[model samples]
Target chain A: MNVKAMQKKWLELGVEVEETEYAKTGYDFSLTLPAEKVHALAEVMLADGFYLVFVTAVHALPAIEVVYQFALASSPRCRVMARTAVRADGTVPTISDIYQGANWHEREARDFYGVVFAGHPNLVPLILAEEDVDLKPLLKEEKNLKDISALRHLPAEAEPKEEKAPAAAKKEPAATDKKAAKPQASN
Target chain B: MNVDVIEDERQHQFVLNMGPQHPSTHGVLRVLLKMEGEYVLDPQPVLGYVHRCHEKIGEYKPARAFMPNTARMDYLGALIYNQGYAMLLERAAGIEVPRRAEYIRVITSELNRIQSHLLWYGAYLLDLGAFTPIMYAFDDREHILDTLEDICGSRLTYCYCRVGGVCKDIDDKFIERTRAFIERLRGRLPMYEKLVNGNIIVQKRMKSVGNYTPELCARYGVTGPLLRAAGVEYDLRKAEPYSVYSEFDFEVPTEQQGDAWAAFNVRYREIEQSLRIVEQALDKLPEGEVMEAKVPKKLRLPQGDYNCSVEAPRGELSYYLVSDGSDIPYRIKVRTPSYSNLSVVPEVCKGMMIADVVTSMGALDLVIPEIDR
Candidate 1:
């Protein structure tokens, strides 16, 4: 399916899908969804001729935001980014079964921020030693962490006005772990 | 004394370790091989030997301070890495590079690409037990290094690129030397084609070895010459057209076989195509300042995430920068090409001869530092 059709499919999945300016964001489309739907999104992306570009995470207030980027390999290239926050238990579903390349990426993410990929076949440390897995070197000190709202540079046309507030408030109570997201700042 | 052997449940199956030191495995990469005699049952590439946490370093340093770290990731294609990071920050901060600076980036990056390919050509042949071709390849590559060294002022791991533009400008002598080096390298290609590509032993070893389908490559997210060799024709330079590459007329050379031979031919032809781009960029070289004058001394990116990808020699080298309006990046995820390129090892090396494993891995151009970083 083309981009429009794919956008409709994602909208049907009951997630917030926003198209952004490629010049500014370097991504044609961006979506924010719950962590559970990422596996389904990965399946749809793979079927739509999109390849996994990279998988990374950002440690922000209220959530550890897991990010996945996909790009169309062919022409009229469209780049898509899907982000989901880590669950309260610090686990997210693995897309390794969907995209084999994600296996390594997920492993690297786990090595850095300690966000576990629940179903990854080999979730061993990819860039760190076995003993150093618990180091979680990329995790920021509490004073240095930023709010999720402050980091997303969404385009003006697609920016949501007040919907983000309630969603973030609900995200705060469940995630109070140290290595995961800190408590939500007052909205 | 008891010997601990890692034996598979199947009869006569044993595990072998290949390098963090072995020559054929290249640059500090270890492959855990599940072998049954000569055939590899599985080749699991164990990485992280040289992992310096380059991305973690990106978080600690200021935006401009991280420039040198980019080159350290892939020393062979250092300039391309520099260009990727520089363009990424430029895009984030809305810094416009000069017209002449873009042309200079194109010329130098393509030259870096050719040097990377030349080294891969020689090193790959050495992995296949050919001694003489490396000498010829390095002899040709030295001219490229000299030309680049004149303007960039470093042989390898060059920190030439800055946030908005290059650190230094190229003079008339640099241009003349680059032109001469381009001509010299162009003359050497045909002989390489005749020497390596036409050899029957090389063909016998390379052809039909490590064959992967386009769909398989896409599934694995493989890019660069390996993907192009599979007939995908998906080059970031052609597909995305970053750094004034759209103006240059050159082909993304491809081969249909999807084997080591095909990858070899694709990279081989890529050298010629890079030379074409360098020549075109040099001819169309604009007259202007190389550095943008108005860039802020204290570089602070707006609050957001910015990502940009450029075609490195191994594949798509991308930087995902997340800034919280700080001079220091909150997080920077480096998506190095070799990491993904080598991820397909277990699937590709299974049931293949042990000797062909080296050829296949060599064909992928595994840079351990880049992968580990």
Candidate 2:
């Protein structure tokens, strides 16, 4: 599914979806939702034949921002990035039940940033030792941390109205379009 | 061969630690195995023995300064990691690389990929109790390392690629040598086919072992040859084209058997496909400067999440870079493919024989540092 249809579907789940330029940003759909709807969105993505790309978190001003990326495994490739800001206690509901691949990613996020995946089964330290569970080494210092708004790449007013023009396009998608124009193997 | 023996009559399972030291486990990975006689009940991989916290290091330095660290994770496919990180920064900062530079990047990276696969082929065969193939595979790989070292000036971990483009340009001698190397590898392929792939014993060992379905790969997010072996024709180069890969015409090899043998064949055929890419890239090598002319000295990326996925030899290697409008990155997430690829082993090896577990894990072509990082 393209961004427009997915945006409508995500909106039905009561979240605002931002359609980003595939040319400018690596992802086509960007959305931020509450922690509860992550599993729902993951189910929809799994139904759409998308695979979990990676799940990571960043330490920002308000809270720890957890980001999940999914990409369509089939043709007419599209990437979707869904983010959720953790609550005061840095807890978000786990989607490991939906995507088994998310289990390790969730653990890695927990190991690095201390963002708890509330219901993750076997949520032990993945890339860290058991002794260093509270290390949270990737978290930024207070002076170095930036506000979430300052880290935003897409402004609300700067949404691409002209999608067809090549000047604003990034190299990868344009290259993919060129390849898609060619005759590919039926398999 | 130490196994836990319980005195209780009902207890049938024994625990076995596979590595963090064993030679076959490959590079400091430990798999805790629950076994009943020769059959494995559960194989849980315990990681982090080699964890260097590469992400934390990515935050402290300038974006360009962390180039060498990317090479260290997947040392075999180092250039591809460097390419991914460079492309992520280029896309984030809107830097344009010259056509010549892109061609050079593809050519060198493909050569690097072929060598990586060759090493995996040799090492995997060795793990499966064959020692002669490693000699042949390393003989071919040496030619690749020599050609690359002529330009990149390194044998293993090459930080040859820079942020905007590559650090050095390829000379005419390099092209001539690479063409000769391709021809030599093509000539040697038939001998390898006869000695390895055509051997009945090898086929018997791998055929129908470690069987998995396409659904299992999708559920676990497996990519590269393992996914292709299960009949998913998804290669990052072809599916999501990056660099000058669009210019090359090649096939994404697939096998429907979905077993260790099929995965082996898929990777073997990829060597031919990669040869086609390198030949095309060298033929289309353009004339110009190798590096971007106006790359800023201080590489400050526009604040946001920027990511690039490149087809590493093992699988899709992606770098998710987040900048805070400063020279230093806010957070850099290296999503190595082996992390996902290795996660599927427990499921695939659930009811498999203890001996066949070596074949199955070797077929995945894991680089442990890449997983631990």
For all candidates in order, the CA lDDT equals 0.85, 0.83
Looking at candidate 2 chain B, the ten consecutive residues that score lowest on lDDT are B1-10
Tens-digit lDDT string for candidate 2 (B122-223)? 999999889999999999999999999999999999999887789999998999999999999999999999999999989988988877677778778888
Q: What are the per-residue Cα lDDT tens digits for candidate 1 across B76-146?
A: 99999999999988998899999899999988999999989999999999999999999999998898898
Going through the candidates in order, their DockQ values are 0.69, 0.48
- Residue-wise C-alpha lDDT for candidate 1, range A97-148, written one tens digit per residue: 9899999999888888888888888888878888886778888887887778
- Give Cα distance to truth, residue A167, candidate 1, Å: 9.6
- How far is B246's C-alpha from truth in model 1 (Å)? 0.9
**Alpha carbon deviation, residue B321, candidate 2 (Å):** 1.0
Candidate 2's residue-wise lDDT over A55-87, tens digit each? Answer: 999887566678998887766678878887775
Ten-residue region with minimum lDDT total, candidate 1 chain A: A178-187
Candidate 1 regions with alpha-carbon error over 4 angstroms? A154-187, B1-10
Question: Which residue pairs show backbone clashes in model 1?
Answer: none
Best model number under TM-score: 1
Number of the top candidate by DockQ? 1
